[model samples]
Structure formats: structure tokens, C-alpha cells
Target: MLNIKYDIVGSFLRPSQIKTARAQYANGEISLAELRAVEDEAISDLVEKEAAHGLKFVTDGEFRRRWWHLDWLKEFDGFTTEHLDIERGGVINHIELGYITGKIFYDPDRSHPEIEAYDFLHKEAGKYPGITAKKCISGPNMILVDNYLQLGIKEVPYYGSDVEGLIEDIAIAYQNAIKDLYAHGCRYLQIDDTSWTYMIDEKFLQKVASLGYKKEEVLDWFQRVSTKALEGRPEDMVIATHFCKGNFKGNPLFSGFYDTVAPIISRIPYDGFFVEYDDERSGSFEPWAVLKGSDATFVAGLISTKNPELESLEDLKRRYAEAKAVVGDNIALSPQCGFASVEEGNCIDEETQWKKIDLLVSCKDFI
Candidate 1:
């Protein structure tokens, strides 16, 4: 069984030096090797810090990439990254979205760069005996929403309106990727996903309707695609899914209770779920009742990551109490999302970020 008490949702605030190195590399002022050297140093320090804090699992802080999803997708075949202005939380933000260009395939050799990333994490984590290295990758649902759905059926003629075929290919590619990660000695993997949260938004539903699709039909597609992707993962591998409601700047993309998606989400085969429960925007814990009798654990994100304000311990306990009342005792604690979902990081200082994690750890046994 996974013995996770207090865990992180991956992605920590990027250090200033690492951010500078990335900017310098992007502007051609520094070589890729120089940038990677700086990243390695930063990630090493971050891992040591998390291990020292007693976190059982640690990430590389996603220091080597910009957006969490695009960075992983760029490694796959048939996906190309492009800059676009996306509106999030009523503001326009320039971000990279991976577009589908040709047939999709997850080439292990091409994915070795990340496998090596995990190698570094595993090596660093080795310095702390009790902790394990965890690698977070974007889920197949991202590909469905960003490339296939957003691009439309006509634009990516390779897919040719064959939604089922598209889902199958994505799932197969993901399965191959998962097996490769396990081969590289990665035992803990979290598939970070945000597309599923959009199902609760009326505007998103209207958009789907305009495309001749029903919301339930699209959700059903996500379920099948997500499940198929987990098909051949090793039984020993601890897999978790994080449901993000979009973290950009300090704002959210969509918000609603988990009511709409719970029936479908409850059936996901992941060992645990890291769910967003930070603010009023995320709605109530009532929907999580569906997981009451299942083996799945709910890592309730009762703390916020978008800002620096530390959540009070009493309030945190109260939130867990409410969720536990619905889902029983298979509960865990984490921030609503990653401290930094992108390179910019959240509008919080490093000291404050650690304090938030300290709070989570202190409250591990509260539920």
C-alpha cells in the first residue's frame, strides 16, 4: 500500500537563479548545457530541502520547463508547441499549447531526457533514505482537450473526426510512456490533468455542444481514454491523478462543485486523487462522498497555492473534517495545487511556500 501521509502536488516555486538561466538560454545568451547545469544545482537543493522536511516523495520542482503540460507533451512525437494568448480567469495570458501536427507516438528513446530527469531526482532522493522520487507527467486528457478538441476535427485531418481512434492512440502512447518511466526506476507517478475540471463549466459545455458533442459524451471519452492509458502500468507503481482547475497568475480558469464530475471521477482507477479544495470557487466536499466505499484516497487540497497567505490550522482541520464526514478516513493533505504551475511561480516568496508545506505536514494526522 502507498504510505503517503503528507504529500505535495508537484511543481515548487522556481528559484530566481534558475529562472534567469532559463531566460538566458531562451535568448541565446547561454548554452543549453549551462542552463541545465544551473537547473541541476537548483533541483538538487530543492530535493534536499523537501527530504529534510520529511516529505516521502519529491519532484525536480519542474525547474527545467515552463508550463507543466507542454513541457512533457513536447517530448512526444507528433506534438508541436506554439505560443498563443489564452484567456484565463478573465485575463489574457500568453502560453504555449502543444498542437497536433501528425500521428502521435510516445518514443521511449526520445523520452529518455525525462527518464534522465527522474534519474537525477532518484539520485538526489537517494541522499535521503526514507524518501522516494516522484515524477509528474501531463495526462492524455490534456492531449484530447488541447490538441484534438481545441484544434477541431477538421483542422487535424490526420485524426479526421475519428474521436475514438484519437483516444485510442493517445492511450497507447501514454501506456508506453508509463512503462518506460517504470523501467527508469520511477515508482511514484502522478498524471497531472486540468481538462476534466472544465466539464463543470456551462460555457465549456456550450462550446462542446457547438461542436456536436454532449458534455456526458465528452466526459465518457475522457474516462475511457484515461483508463486505457493506465492499462499496463506495473501493479507496484503508485499512480495518482491531480485534478487542476487551471492555475495562472493567482487566478483560476473554471470553478464549480465536484458534483457534476464526481460520478465519473469516482470510477478512475488511480490509487489516490489530489483534488483542489482551496477556495469557495472549488465548491463543497459533498460530491466526494462517492469515494466513501472505494479503495481510493482523497488528498484534499485545503490550502491555497496561488497566494502567500498561510491557512490557519483550525480552518484546515475544519475543512478536512467536512470532507472526512463525506468520504470517511481515506484522506490526505496537500496544497490546492502546485506552488508553481508555470515558470513564473505563484505570487509568494520561497519562505512562505515552505511554511505552507510545513502546515500540511503538521496536519497529516488531523483527519
Candidate 2:
């Protein structure tokens, strides 16, 4: 029999106080230091709640940024903030591309944002010493997507000035970032990635085909990039890849099935894969066999945060069982995504968010 372990993928569940502080920061009423104080208090409360819920792997809930991962990377170099194009979605980003600290950090020129968000995760984890602390970061490839296309930077870097160099730097930077978190005693890492979804998009797919690449070739690209980022890391490190379909406000950017890119998704292995199977928009779970790794674990997203309706335990269990039918029993449970991928959060409130996690905890037998 497979030894099934249960855990939940972590994300920021925004609190009311943090929202007020954001307005204060906007109106110039609170200095950055003051803002930090408010953020600290919110994180303290969030950590307490997770403890109350008995979650073994706890996160600060990504409270640091206004957007999902982009907001968090304001600390990196070669980036700057700018007026966002209304059509292209993004969070608060480093203004230009000059501040990139490397594949993982910024230059020691004191250019990095002096925010304590990531470390705050350490503080809360230490407080609960009983639960494992998880740190979430945008997957390496996703950073490349958000940086170049969303911001409309057409120029290439001189180091290589092409896709190859770009991907290498992303992997390198992630390693550095992971090292920093590990030094602070973090044992779990989840890379939030939406790149695969983009690859399967109609427009982007046409763009790749325009370059004379075959469908199989594009799929290989996803596997290679994802694998490159996972390369040469500590075997004991609990690294997970989140297969997301974009979360902005309560809106989603794309959706499809794992079969579209099954070859690579299944081959480029990781300890666990966090996937969305909450609705048919994600198609059937048939491709999960492709995602199956030897001794590999899976976090089945049976609870959805997009809608406010709290899924019934019976209904959630049915969904979990459906995934098990294909992968044959190596499955876990979590919401399709965070209660709040951005500041506004997924169309739900704190009450509903807790109810969702509570459901996961309640459905332990299925998980």
C-alpha cells in the first residue's frame, strides 16, 4: 500500500487590516516602515489561524505583494515599476529590467527593496515550530513570461540575447533565492508556474508555429524549461510545481487539459505537482498518468477559491476520488488556487477561505 501523506499548498489569504494599510500607503499617511508594522501584525494573525486549523505546512499567505508573484519579486534587480497597460495584466513590478540581481537575487548595491515579507514567513514558522513553513515563488519560466510580454520589453540581453540565456538566468536566480530561504531554515518550496498554460494558448501557439517549431517541439520546451529550474537541487528539498490557469481579480487567463503537454509534464519530475481539477474547464483527469512520477506525490485541487460557494465535503471527496481513479491513489487536496492571488483576492471572504481549508482538513480520509 502507498503511504499517503496529507498537506495543503500555501498562498496569501488577505486580511482586512492589510487592505487598510495599503490605502494608507497609497495616501502617504503611512511611511514604508509604518506599512511594515501593519503587515507584521496581519502575518501574526494569519499564522495563528493556520495553527488553529492544524495545517502541517503553513505559509504567510503571500501578504507581501499587490499581485501574485510579480508583487513578491519587487526585491529583485533589473526591474522597475511603471504605468501598467490596462489590457495587459500585472502587479507592482520592478520598474525596468536593469535591477535583476541574478537568477535569484539582486546586486548588493542596496538596490533591493528592504521588505521583510519573505523573512516574516520564517518568523511565523518559528513561532509554530510544530508546522513546516512553505515559501512560494513564481516559477523561473513564468518570470520570463511576465517580464518580457506583459511589460513589452522586446530587447534581448547581451549575455546571450536569446531564449537560451534567458532561461538559464531564470534557473540560476531561482537557485540563489532558494539558497537564501534555506539559509533561513525553510524546508518546503512551491514554484507558482503558469507558463505551460500560456504555451497551449491559441495566440502563443501560433507564434511558436510561425517560427517553424512542431507541436511536439513546443511541448518539449515546457518540459526542458521546467526541468532546468528543478535541476541539481537538494534531493531532500520538498519542491513542488503549481500548474495554474492564471488568477487575476476573480478572472482566469487560460484553461486546458494536461494531455496537450503530457509528455513533458510527466517527464520533468518534481517531488509533487499542484494541479487544478476543480472544474471541467480544466478538462478530464486522464493526463494525470503522464504527471505520475516514481514515488511522486500530487496535490489534487478539489476545492475552488474562484467562486464563493463552499464546496460540500461529500462533493469534494467525489472529486478527489475521481483523480485517484487515474493516478491510482497518490493524491492530496487543496483549493484550485489561493483565496487571493492578488490584493483583492479570489471572489471570496476570510470566512469562505477558512471554510475551504477546513473542508480539506475535514476530508482527511480521502486525501
Candidate 3:
């Protein structure tokens, strides 16, 4: 088994300027050269801040991508954006609120439409000296999940023909993207697969089951897409998967434990797993115990990134003790989810975010 010292899910929140630059460049208002300059400065600042906190692993905060995972697919060669009417999620018991339908392409239309987006983020994060940078990719299964659900997508974007063929092309496109990211020194690539956890919800499960899929078939769907997309990658390099029901609107989509999905997760070859445990909705420690004797490092989500209210030292310690008892000291901790899973910051403001970080540092020894 691979043993690691210290317990840190090291990464940071993205800065705002990168978004501004991407906009200006996309609208043809500024040259790509100008955007690169902005990205360079922004990435440098991001690295410096992460290092200042004494973080061992760092990310560029996904400085180049707009949405965390989807945008990476946009960088693949066979992808094109086409709008299809996809569903929007609700608040609590997060359901499909509505659809902000528009045309989108399935292609990687951003920049360098050859491979994946992670290596570029990794490269940007690498520019900073001395910090071990990380790259986060949208899990291949995530894109397939979005396609299958037709989530938030509008039907007919700029790619007006051959829809079925295009979907197959997308899967192939992602395969190449994953390979390219691996080639570029991405020893620490985290596939952001939050969608899988959302699948265990009763409402959604009922819907998919209505489509004629049984429990075994649905479980196979999860394993097939996830493992196939992750196939043929390097073993020594770490590839971790993260799942939270949903961080939108301070509402969660499902309230179940790893007990439901742990069997599927344990069978996968991923080196580590990160899960949310910040609220009662997340269920109990038994979810992780399923991976007993497994090498996968479980980063328990003991802290909440959505609410500004800080988790007191005592409470966090107690939570960790419980997790340690169940999963042993192999567990690490991170904010329950990304502070900004989408553009809007979580209910928490920037100051509270830093305070939480300070607490994480204070308890480094306990880790």
C-alpha cells in the first residue's frame, strides 16, 4: 500500500481575474497573447498564496476553466457545443429547478483543442517554484452523466447535425484528453466526479429506474463509464475521485452514506477518494468502512465550505476521531466541497474561508 505523511487535500479557491480575461478574449475584445499575460500573473499569485499557507499540494484554482469539469471537455478536439434543453437543479432535496436552455457544442472550443485541460492548469500551477501542484479534471463519467441526464443543456447548438454520432465522439475525445494530461507530469490528477453521489438519490434513482435500468445495471453504468474513461493511465501517479451530493443553494441532493456507493468505489482502481461528511444529510462513517484494507486514501469532508459559520476546534476534532475510528488515520480533511462549485461563492465569504484555513493549520498535528 502507498503510505503518505500528513493529511491535507491541498488546493485553493480560484481568483476572479482569470474569468475576466477569458471573457474579453472570447468576445474577440482582446488578443490571446493578452489573455496569456493575465493568466500568467493570476497563476503566479495563486501559487504564492497557496504556498504561504504551507500547503503541500496546490492547484491553479482551475484558473483557465470556467466551470470546473465541463470546460475541460470543451478543450478536446472532437467536442463542439450544442444547446439542448437540460435541467437545472433545485435547492434543498436539490431537484431540477428549471432549464436555462441554450445552444452549446460538444467540442473543445476554447484553446488548444487537441487534448485535455488539466495539463494546462498543471502547467500554469507549475510556474511557481517549490510548490507541488495538482490538476483537477472533470471525471469522464461526469460528462457521460451530464449527457445521459441532458442536464442544463439545450438541444441544438452550433453543432446542428448527427447528434448520436457526436455523443460517441465525445467519449473518444475524453479518452485522448485523459491520455494527454497523464503525459504532462500530472502525478496528482483529481477527477472531480460529484455527479456519482447525486445518483443515489431516491427521486433520481426512481426516474432512471423507470427508464428500465435495474440496480445492477445502474451500478454497472457507473463502473463502466468511470473505469473505461480512466483506463490505461499510469499507476504510480495518483488519481483520486471526489463526490458530494450537490453544493448548490446550500441544499443537498441526497442523504445517504458511502454504504450505498462504497462497493462501486472500492472496485475501481483510483488511488484515493474524497467524500463529503459535513452535514447530517451525508449519513454516517460506515460509508468509508466499506473500503477496509483498501489503499485508497479517504479525505473525509469534516469542514463545510458552504456556510460561513466556522466549525469549532472541538467539534472538528470529535468528527475526525469518529472518522479515524472508522477509516483509520488514512483520512484527510478539506472544505466539504469547493467554496465555489459554481461561479457564486458559497454562502460563506472570503474572510470566513481564510479563517477555516487557519483552523485547518492549527490542527495540522492531529492530522
Candidate 4:
């Protein structure tokens, strides 16, 4: 079993230097190498901060990319993005929709940017003894949702109406990517997914029904695809999935209880689960009983990354105790989600973000 006591959901706020460097690169003011140098320095600094704050695992803060999921998803062979006039936040204002143009596949011969980024992170975090470099990628279900379900496209060029075929291909692509990352020295991997949380919303379920699909089938597909993607994972590699309720511009996109989907989520063969419980919107901790007797570690997200208000230690301890009552002692602590799911980040500032981290570190004894 994984023994991590305190953790993060991955993706920290992008520093100003990295943001400016990206703009300069886009406008042709700086070359790709120059932009990378800036990102390298910023990531190094972020890793140092995470270590200094006493986190056992360190991430590059996902500093190099704009959107948490799209940047990684679009890297695959068959996926593409279409730019739209829509914008998300004030700092970095751009929106794009992803689509599948061809059969999804992972070509091992091609260089993967996320793998390269993990190489840098692994080396940098290696500087501090006992610090594990964690790599966070968008989960396979996100690809299924963004490319097919959300677009209301039941058929594609290659798969046509064969939805199960599409799911299998996505799973295979992820399996290949996971294997590739493992070869690159990634031991701790986290997959961030919002589809499971989206399923909790009635309207989202309605949409699925409107598209001639049953909610139960979609849930089963999510579990099957997730399990298939993790096929052949080494015994030492620890994989976790974070179910986020949407963190954009300090606002949440969905809110409801996890009761309906808890059993389905518990069935996925992940080593750990990063669940959001920062507010009343998440409902009671009763649903966590589904994980009872399971070996998976449960990271209860008690602090809110979307706001600057620090959580009271006593209250946090109380919540953790409540969760432990239902899920047993394999619980860890973390913020509800990443500080920034997008480039603009939540409404909170950097100082506030670190303060929140400090609070999480301070609560390590609860485990």
C-alpha cells in the first residue's frame, strides 16, 4: 500500500515569468529555447518551494502548460484542438475544443513532451533526498468526454458508430503512454479527471441520456477504460486518480454528492484517491464507506485551493476524523484540487497558495 500521508492534487499557479515567457514566444519576441529556459528556472524554483514546505512529493507545478488537461491530451497522435473566441480567465484568456481526427494511437518513436518534462522534474526533485517527483496527466475519460460526449458526436471518421472501439483505443493509447512514462523513471503518477464528478450532476446525466446513452453504461465504460489503461503497470509504480469538481477562476462548475458514483469510483484499480470534501457541496463523508476494506489510500481534500481563507486546524482535524470513521486509517490530507487547473489559476494569490500549503503540512500529524 502507498504510505504517503500528505499530498497535493498537482498543478500550482503559473509564475509571472513563465506566463510572460509564453506570451513572448507566441509573439516571436523569444525563441522556443529561451522560453524553455525560463520555464526550467521557474519549475526549479517551484520544486524547491514544495520541498521547503515539507511535501514528500514535488511537481513542476505544471508551469509549462496553459490548461491542465488540454496541454497533455493534445500531445497524442490523433487528437487536435480547434481554437475558439471563448476565454477563461483574465491572465490567460483563450479557449479551445479538442477533437479526434483519426484513430488514437501512441507512437513510441515520437518524443512526448510530458515525458521530457517529467525527466526534468525527476532530476530536479532528486536533489532533495526522500522527495518523489510526481507526474500528473489528464485521465483517459477526459479524452472520451471532450472529444466524443461533449461534442455530441456519436460517430467519428475511423471508429464510425463503434463507441466501444473508441474507448478501447483510448485505453490502449493511455496504456502505451503510462508504459513510456514508467520507462522514463516516473514512479508516482496521478491522473486528474472531472468526468466522474460531472456524472453526479443531474443535468449532465440528462445530457448523456439525450445522446442515446445510459448513465450506467458511461460509468462502466469509465471504469473499464481506467482499469485497461493501467494494465501491465509495474508493482512499484503508484497510480492515483483525482476527481475534481472543476476549479476555474476560483469558481466551481459542478457540485453534488459522490454517493451515486462512489461505488463505481471505488472499483477502479488505482492505488490512491484524491477526493474533494472542502465544502458542503461535497456532501457528507458517508459515501467513502464504499472504500472500506480496500487497500487504496484516500487523500481527503480538506483545504480549499480556490480561495485564500485558511482552514482552521481544529476544523480540519474534525473533518479528517469524520472521514476516517468511514474510510479507515489509510487517509491523507490535501487541498480540494490543484491551485490552478488553468493558467489564470484560482482567485487566490501566490502568497495565499503557499500559506494553504503550509496549513496542509502542519496537519500532517492527523494521519
**Candidate whose lDDT is highest:** 4
Q: Kindly give the number of clashing pairs for every candidate.
A: 0, 21, 27, 0
Rank by lDDT, descending? 4, 1, 2, 3
The digit string of per-residue lDDT tens for model 1 on 1-367 reads: 3467668999999998998898898899999899989999999999989987868889999988788888888777877877889775577888876777777788887635777788898899998878899999998888878764565544664787677887788899999999999988989999998888888877777777888778888899899999999998899999999987888755677766778888897787998889999888888888888988778888888889886888999998888889888887787888889988888988888899999888888896664
Better of 2 and 4 by TM-score: 4
Which residue ranges in model 4 land beyond 4 Å of their true spot? 86-93
TM-score of each: 0.95, 0.86, 0.80, 0.97
Give the lowest summed-lDDT range of ten residues in model 3. 93-102
Model 1 stretches astray by more than 4 angstroms? 86-92, 153-157, 365-367
Per-residue CA lDDT of candidate 2, range 1-367, in tens?
A: 1123555656656778888998999999999899888888888888888888878778888776776666655656544454443544555532222223233344333433323465677778777757777777776665555554444344544433365665666566566666666665667878787778777677766665665555665455556667876666765677777877877776777766767765577666667778877778888788777644456677788778788887888887787787887776667777788777778777777788888778778888656
Candidate 3: residue 120 lDDT (0-100): 51
Give the local distance difference test score of model 3. Answer: 0.63
C-alpha lDDT of residue 226 in model 3: 71
Task: List the global CA lDDT of all models.
Answer: 0.84, 0.68, 0.63, 0.88
- Residue-level lDDT for 204 in candidate 3: 76
Best by TM-score: 4
